[model samples]
Target: MPVDRKSLFKRVPSGIPGFDDLIEGGFPENTTVLVAGGTGTGKTTFAAQFIYRGAELYDDPGVFVTLEERAKDIRREVKSFGWDFKKYEDEGKIVIIDGVSSSVGLPSEEKFALEDKFNVDNFLRYVYRVVKSINAKRLVIDSIPSLAFRLAEERQIREVLLKLNTILLEMGVTTVLTTEAPAPQEGRISRYGIEEYIARGVVLLDLQERNIELKRYLLIRKMRETKHSMRKYPFEITSDGIVVYPSGEIY
Candidate 1:
């Protein structure tokens, strides 16, 4: 009797092993997801894997926009997991857009560095060109808070998020955006407090000390279409990448 809206849209696999099961095969195609976490909580890995594996497994090209960290640094970090980001770049499977150097008044060596950083309009145009060039199906914005340096007002930040989401969706690219989540005591899931509102899904990574042992946990706080677990799920950063135990609960 009820309609299944999910049937109306196709799903794109998240590309992270064991992570797709939590979201019913994958994310709704072309939707935006926000991945929030504190320092060293594996947010970067999660987002990178989404881009890498999407290209590796599903033949989905991707665009990774590094707003805070250098694209090379992110590449080096993910290389420990055996992912050769350079190979993908060479093969035209992935584009690592440098958004950092311009923001810092330095010239970028990246092939896809942004000419005008912190300007949402410029960023969107660059994204459009890159996505079109690669026919990218997935995209990533490393951290939303980094935009705060130039966008001093909350309204401006929110508008940037909205425009980013709208542009990404219009381009038909499944996007995963990363942001810093303050500590549990801060009472906010995202640094800006508005990133989650503009996304179709929100996955928060948390590092908590339990029984004197530090553990990594993931929570699917909000997803628009598919049924997802609200309970925090146990995850780990193994030699490969982030692995989420869909059935395991933190309790």
Candidate 2:
């Protein structure tokens, strides 16, 4: 049973308004993408919208691994956009794995003791079980930097991410992993310098001041095996979810 090259290149739509047009249909199927941004940049919302839309419109089952927020809190937040995550869960179309609760015993106040308790293998196994249970095709890790913060050394962070990427590919799921980015810095896609390289695609969300108004923009930094737009497009968060303006000027 060999996998078809056409199936390998299949695109999975993010379902965010005006977003798909920039990436030539959508993201390549089963590819791991890193969504990096600073605080208040709508990184979590983008991931949630992608998952919710996939379940609601595309009929694709999705799994959302929440590293920071509680599963209930995430569901409540998406409710504002008329996305009933709970309903999807009840229907077995979506699953939310609570990474925060599972890692609660790990030392948070002391940075030095994090690595002692952080078990990457255990975490991956937990995620694997959840993904398999749901038969998910789409996956989202709310934020990868939060998970990386638990590691004591930079090498460990890189190794964990590389391993995570391999695991996701083996499962054949399209994944969106979020990471925190330094404030508009030069050449920094994520808090850890290696995240962008580990993932097959990198999409950046940013906020900038324009005439005293804060404007949000989305940029496709890199997408392997596909032609994509290189422009920084303006976007907005509305009641419906994230909406990209691909043709609109950033300045």
How high is the CA lDDT of each candidate model? 0.86, 0.84
What 10-residue stretch in candidate 1 is worst by lDDT? 146-155
TM-scores, all candidates, are 0.92, 0.89
Which lDDT value does model 1 have at 110? 87
For candidate 1, the TM-score is 0.92
Best by TM-score: 1
**What is the per-residue lDDT of model 2 for residues 45-66, given as tens digits with 9 covering 90 to 100?**
9999999999999999999988
- Give the Cα error of residue 41 in candidate 1, in Å: 0.7
Kindly report which residue pairs in candidate 1 clash with one another: none
Report the poorest 10 consecutive residues by lDDT, candidate 2. 107-116
lDDT of 2: 0.84
The local lDDT score (0 to 100) that residue 120 gets in candidate 1 is 68
